[model samples]
Target chain A: MSGKSLDNRRVQKFHWMSRFLSGWAIFRQSFLGKIGLTLLALFALMALCSFIPPLVDPMYQPMAGVDPEISTVTGPSTRHWLGTDFMGRDLLSQLLAGARVAFMVGVSAAFMSVFLGTAIGMIAGYMGKFADTLLMRLADIIMVMPALVVLLMLAALFGQLSIWFIVFFIALFRWPGVSRVIRAQTLSLKHRPFIEAARVAGASHLRIIFRHITPNVLPLSFLYMTFQVTSAIIIEAALAFLGFGDPRTISWGMMLQWVWKTGHMFNAPYWLLPPGICISLITLSFYMLGRAMDEVLDPRLRKEGQTD
Target chain B: MGNGKQTILELDRIVKRYRTKGFFFGAHGQDVIALNEVFIKILRGEIFGLVGESGSGKTTAGRLIVRLEQPDQGKIYLDGRDITGLKGKASKDYSRRVQMIFQDPYQSLNPLLSVFDTISEPLIIHKIGNAEAREDSVWQAMKSVGLSPPHDFAHRYPHQLSGGQRQRVAIAHAMVLKPEFVVADEPTSMLDASMSAQIFNILLEMRRRLKVTFLFITHSLAAARYLCDRIAVMYKGNLMEIGPAEEVLRNPKHPYTQALMDALPKFVHSGGVKRYETLLQAEREVSGYVGCPFFVRCKVARAPKCSREKPPLKKLDDSHSVACFYAEPGIKTRSGGKA
Candidate 1:
């Protein structure tokens, strides 16, 4: 006769990992998650090809487009494709390199924001009192700051920062909104009857937060992540456009900076239009994907479509 | 009253209070006494009914017994072990022995969990068996609660089921572990009259087969009469009367109990006039050595002593207990007579 509970082993079997796997499954089935992953996959393929010389472009040799001598500076042509900038760089090749940078910045910054926001928000929402007030007020302070000014200050202080540095820096401003939403969710979710049920069942605080609250907020974090990626890309573009871009790496915003500085605004529609359109499409894809993911994940977060 | 018949669960001087937000900053928050010096002993294999009005603390007392909420000043003993101080593993082990069925079926069962998952959750939480064995027990539990062809209902979420089916799922969840004592907090109050009756029968069957002791909390005395062996009537957080269900309903002692019986609508043409008594200022006045909580609305209240002293739960017979100073068993109840 074992002097132990028959149910103890069974209860312990319910690990947090099982729920996380289930959450990923649910997100995968979502329409936005599907399209978002697909678009991201395509970008990832392009980014991977960017490392190879011949793979990026068959006609132009590696670093050939950068020189002002190899290609003629002209408006949209059949030979040059998206024509050439004042520096004689291929706008199409520069755009491809920009996509790689966009993907990196967007993804890394979004990951940082979501991870910090979730941790901060979950703690504030679950802990209550002093911790709650402290974190929420911190978020409030960050949320009210002007995004452009903060980026400008950072860029001026640390000239030509690496892509990862910009990613982490931008993420600092990005976390407040996510934290606010997640904290609000944790507040409301904590009061749910099931949460009470779990507590009464002798579930530890950490167990309830990770097993219950975490899964519930995951879809929300994911939906926010998509929007975060979109904003991250735009923010990076804006920084690059303002001449804070790294000289070593080329991006859509860097191309726009070149276009503006060269005084080829009206003359080179080929140079100007490509980067702007790419930026719009990338942002649009994320927003569309986010909305669709929300619709599938949580109906409460789902915004009514135009048809409604 | 057999020698071997054990008391499965007992509450001694249980007091629960909630602090309301203060009117001003740094102001002392007012405490709402949800239960006051309450004591109960639920015998093994018996459906002990706790009947009262909406704000009478029936649910609070139920929650306290199962350790859902800690009592401000009291001790909860399960099978003669003081379990209120239990922590971590010991507390979880205690949870295995004492389970609860909440009032709202829709809110009780997690929306994301399927019928099978909801029923199996307790077993899963308690670490009962392997997956195959757990599934076997789950199907048996579901069948016992009348969820036939368990396979068809296993994958269906709570939103897909009817009110009765959902409550059945809730019942299956509570009884799956075969707990020694279960506190059912108004299990059928949320359902329609017909559905409520079916749910009650299922509860009765589970009680019969499992021999599980129950602290049944409900506002409806009629449901209590149909299910309980002994009934405890409460009012404004005070136990008004406790006796055999048939005796309490057939011949009520407390005036509040009489008022409750009088309020029941009867279609028969009988000229039995009902008297109304304005309950003395007992509404929301929680703290203080304040008199009887029901004195303000008591129909048979006389002297001001009731307003000055809180009545203690006193035993009148081997099986009967009343908390009122003026409660006399011989007195004929005006309403609920021969109808």
Candidate 2:
């Protein structure tokens, strides 16, 4: 209210802004963070660019006929920048479309699983009698079961799995693991004085969970989500390579599956290499980002920030 | 009756018991009678200190008043209106009117929240002011609590502040709400001597400025002597003595009060002992007992019926009362309650 206090307020405003910006500034300074951000931006660009569509037929729709005279095999021509498949399908188009599919599967799977798991965990942790017993026991059962085997069995039972089906089942199985982790975290957080403080502040049960408890658990969510992006992408790739991916979708794993089935893997190295490299680079980027973020969120991991 | 003090808060015979897990995997462990038939009236603009040893239920009494834990029985009246069984908005409004400064500022505050956010959150929750007004309010609160310049301390986390500073922040949080009634539970036990004095001074200043009625809970009699207008000594969930602070300290009546006075480390001619008592007698489990909860260790319990029957809180004079049967030793008659 006073002139001096007003001046201090303005100074505080600037300080608060800087503290907000510091998270990004600190993250950008890290070596792994730079690479991770660059890789993410690059793939995101690829995924976005695929939507615009190029002038030429990058993927040879009818497989270009097996005859050598027609359009059987071609190296990197002006039309197909990456090259052509043994069946003469354009490798560049496959790569572009594959980026879109991987992005969709990865983001959707991670988002859904994390959202569902956080909800389950918050409820189970905060409201701990029957809800905890029921939800946690269910999580335990799902966690104990072999995830890949279950995914495969479900894929086979459905017969030619759809994109949504894969996303649904992958998220369903994945959430149990996240729920258990978050439940353990929420159990501890619910007892903290801050939670009781919120209760005293007139917060409803929903508000306490969503506002008070959830924000405290947000760092874990971000950390889990980053690793989950990698896991979801890998799981999608694994499903596709095992011939369980949606037949209509042309993912990186489907490209590899084609290369393996055709027996010309060594003879035509270009077809085999691009998808494998993209998968590794994307997953590696996510892993690096996750690790970098771990250091940022939990300052104890950073050497300079370490203090009692 | 002629003290002209208006009662701001009153508890009418409240009882609370917590059932802990029994040892050896039994279905029932030792149940703790946190408070039993505890009654006290806090007057307006006065510091009423609830002094007791550990496990004496002083904290629980404070907590009951704050409605952090509800009493299993009895009524709580604020401003002579029974605010018992308040739910939803009523409960929140009660919180707004009556705030608590918890014992440990370290664990009481949320680590992720800045000091500004911590103090301003109550304002935001209550929807008291807009952003700019809140900034000003927060600045004023910080200044009042002696974390002056406000800007330096406002943006800092709990870890960055010292123990004394953290307690100041906690005090600011309650002060921002402008609650008329504040229950400060050992607000300075964690701080050093000078720091504790500084905190006590801030509390004293707040009381003078705002006419805030405080129920100060502490085990240290020194703190009671320093700040409280009135004092109540508790033992094993029962109130032993209640009176004007100076009168009770000078001319104590209850056996428990005398024991506490004797136990004071010879520094009583001054304001208080240099340190808090290191050896509080190990509390005996007093649940399911009929007599005085203090009977197990009462050095002056002369009556043959001391262990067999409970004594009533009887008045000896205008401003003093004790729960001892032999307060007037010449009269050997049982007053009111049956064994």
Candidate 3:
């Protein structure tokens, strides 16, 4: 009994150690897929800024001044590098404070879009018939309308739309394209032998879809989610730049909007350029990362790479 | 014929029709009868071979037997139970009893999963054991299929395996559930000649070991002759003949079966004499048609009767049955065009 217990402990240790090693290897390999790694790092940093209080204290707000016209880069030497705006608030702190908001909107929108799109696509492809017809037609109708225009109109009417509301709107518009892709993939996968095997194995319809079908398509969904986040961030930035963002909360886009309105283009390029550069870099990184993930995750592409 | 064994599966007057439309607008839609009143009985522990060419509805019949596709009109009985429209738990139970092995081995196993996980999936779904026991069962299954050492194979992915190894994995996956009846639909078709033989041997071994009944569907008559005890010839969704494998292969009464036998490349003969004559004979016979399905390709086809009226299945001997109008007693020496 003692020997068996020791063996069990050894096996458990081996399993966990292997898992850690594999995870480390994956992390290492991700660095080779440079674009994805950079974006992932940025996203991680953004997440970190949200939970870490000192990283994003309200005292570091850059643009919190009584006279809005006065532009000065002056703050605490060690903590606030970008200095204070018109309100003598630290720019670094405000930027850090806004990280959580950006991540919340981006990730929430992506999750909603992916969930709804994948479910709809799987249902349409697997069940087919009238359900497919109706859903696809609805998707088409939604796709025809200009998404940005609708979002702008909605935001204007709502007047300082909540983060969740913005996420909902973004997701509602974003799902159509992903739905089509996922539907096509699901349609092909439905006819595969594994699905038939699942059927013959006495698996229920829901079980087959969730267990067999969903896992097969999950990597593709993940890749698409990354792309979705990049798009969501851009859209959120665009909305904020156009003055539809929450006035009370300062985001990267809000920073850009402030810079543009105050006509800082002549004197201080640094203030406007930092947020703009960050936005472009983050989006580009995500796109590159998504492409790399697509290549790696897809078995067909992986096989091709192996052969070559 | 008089053994009177209990039928484990039966397809009574099954019919499956598919509606097809043209690519262009306003093109007339037509109904293609994929299976027209097809009937067959599979006895318990019997390896019943369903042999046919492409589009013969053999795969469709196999699908119907497993309830993967519901037949338009039919009653399917499993172990004297009416499973025609069984749903939910009843259907699931039926599925567990009767499993199906698909044609392509490559597509049969999920590409993403490891060998152990793939084999253990059914056990997991059926709640056969806890995690530890399920893993043990998976390893046992892998070892049984000659994928040893089991530990080595369990960790390896699908792409790492060869075609034959992949096929073995697929078979292991199917057999892991210990199903009573298995429908191996052209399981060896995609395999190489040597690999095909290996798979056939493995299947035979599995049958002996597990005592599992198999409905082996194949287009290859040679394969059917080797593995199947009884063979059923299918022509355009119709069961033309069914009998002992040796009897069907050696003395084929159906013209389609005879033609198929003749089409097999003889080892001794070369290009000129035997080959051309066989080809010419096949073409001449296949050109003329009547009511019988094989009439279009029968060397010994009669005039009006063969074309006008469909031949019902008639028992020729104790073990053999042929669906030919002229399958009468002591009528073997009929005047023919070519021997």
Candidate 4:
């Protein structure tokens, strides 16, 4: 409370605020950050589109006949942006709808995977010995199982897999890799003074694991989640492409399946191209976002900021 | 607060043997004696130093006292209560009363936690106060350790701080609970010489201000001399000598104690003359013995007896004790030496 110390406080606060501002400025300056922001904005726009009904007229069908005339003059028009598919559905509308499905499966599955994986890993690493032995063995078993084969088996048993079911399957299988990552991080963190400090402070085992250890593993979990989301999207798309998806839903994968089944690639390339491009863009965006987060969350990456 | 309740901590005949797994399909494992029949008592408000070489079981003894590891055979009493095999809530309470400070400051702190959360977590867990009060206590604890402008430090992460700063944060975290006893296991070993002195000074100041007892473990004989009121010397899991710091350092009756004193750098010495060469020669001669733990290293050790029989701690004065067979009444060597 002395005048000198009070002045010192003001100086320290000023320094901290300056450092935070500079960090923010540097993040904005990075190309990866811009890409991440753009992808996130696209995802949000797609989510918003889900709430707003599609602009296409449900009854209107440009390809009324079996072999519709292929149009070459169509680039982007008021009637159909990005041209029309063989079925004459609005390509832009289908792309937007596909975005909604991709984002849903990508985000939900990733969130579930990270949450369950982090919790189980923290418990296994912190409690150690018996709990560690049991949980890691289970994780190893899950890790060795082929994800696609298991999903196919489940889909066959269920007759048809819905979007939610696909998300659940991906999330369940996605945890093993993340759990292993988290467990490794936790093994080192559990020995730290802060944990011992917590123990001496009379914190319970549950509190120690959740409050102390969980925060330490969060950056790793977050980075892993981003990668998991990309993987989940790929898995869902693979399932839909293999004709195991819900019949009523019109995901990009289902669009591909229908296009391939109808021989649209040989007759009408436009029909197959739109869905293929949409899937690639969506998956690529998630991969880029994961890479950006890897740079942001990793200490080694951030340390280079000083040199730069 | 009552008569016969002065002893805050006691370890009686404590032994810890670690069982190592056999190598490559071997039938049997090896038993390494980490602690062998060690006994010590810490009175209230006294700083007791346990000094020894590495693998001497000083660190193991500290861990056993806190029940971080269980002793193979022993009874540990705290405030007249036998807490040897206690677990769950009782063990937790004991831990709260007696905390530990580890050697590596960098490895000892969670890298992800901010300074505020790191120190306040314990307070929150113990339900010591409301959120506002906990914040106040965390700031207060930081301030006490000279982590001044506490608000600044509260939001900063561990990696942002220097070695001395991190150690200060660690001390604040340990002291925030207002524990009655602390087991500092080579707390300053990881610090530089200058920082080590500062840390020792802070510990001394805290000891005076809070009246907390300390079981300070270290391999540094000079540190033991500087900070401790009483010193116990150990060699290979044996408590070789225990007495007043001045008595032990000035007139060391045990050969191991004498060697440790003789080995100390002379510039830091307040009384002893230069005897570095003699100490080094003795150390070389004592490196081949299979008998007494120190028989291989003791220059003054008598043949047959010194190498054959392990010495028991014998009282030489009211406050001084030495563990050597020759430390008995009327026992004199050729030079009339009293070791």
| lDDT measured at residue B111 in model 3 versus the true structure, 0 to 100 | 76
Alpha-carbon TM-score of each model against the true structure: 0.85, 0.83, 0.86, 0.86
lDDT of 2 by residue, B1-339 (tens): 236988999999989889898767568977788888988888899999999999999998888887778898889999988877898888889889898888888887888677888898888888887777888899989999999888788778788899999999999998898889999999998889999999999999999998899999999988899999999999989998899888777767776776687687774455553222222265544555578766766645543566678889988877678888777633422322222
lDDT measured at residue B31 in model 3 versus the true structure, 0 to 100: 72
Docking class of 1: acceptable
lDDT at residue A191 of model 4 (Cα atoms):
73
Question: What is the Å distance of residue B23 in model 1 from its true position?
Answer: 3.3
lDDT of 2 by residue, A32-140 (tens): 9899989999999988776544433423432332324335556776666667776667777778778889889988988888888888987898899999999999998
**Span of ten consecutive residues with least summed lDDT in model 4 chain B:** B330-339
Give lDDT tens digits, candidate 4, residues A1-308. 24434554565577557655755565566677668668778766975674443423542222221113444323445666556655555555656677778888889999999988998888788778999999999999999999999999988998987778888888899898898889998998887766766666677888878777886688789888878888888888888888997676667887777677766656656667877876777677777777766655554665454421
Query: Which segments of candidate 1 are over 4 A away from where they belong?
Result: A1-64, A67-72, A292-308, B1-4, B268-289, B333-339
Q: List clashing residue pairs in candidate 4.
A: A193-B108, B286-B296, B286-B297
Q: Which model scores highest in DockQ?
A: 3
lDDT of 4 by residue, B186-223 (tens): 99998899999989998998899999899999999878
lDDT of 1 by residue, B244-332 (tens): 88888877777778777767766675457553332333443335537877766564554467778888877777777788887765765
Task: Please report how far candidate 2 places residue B59 from its true position, in Å.
Answer: 1.5
Which CAPRI level is candidate 2? acceptable
Model 1 C-alpha lDDT versus the unseen true structure: 0.78
Q: Select the stronger candidate by DockQ from 2 and 3.
A: 3
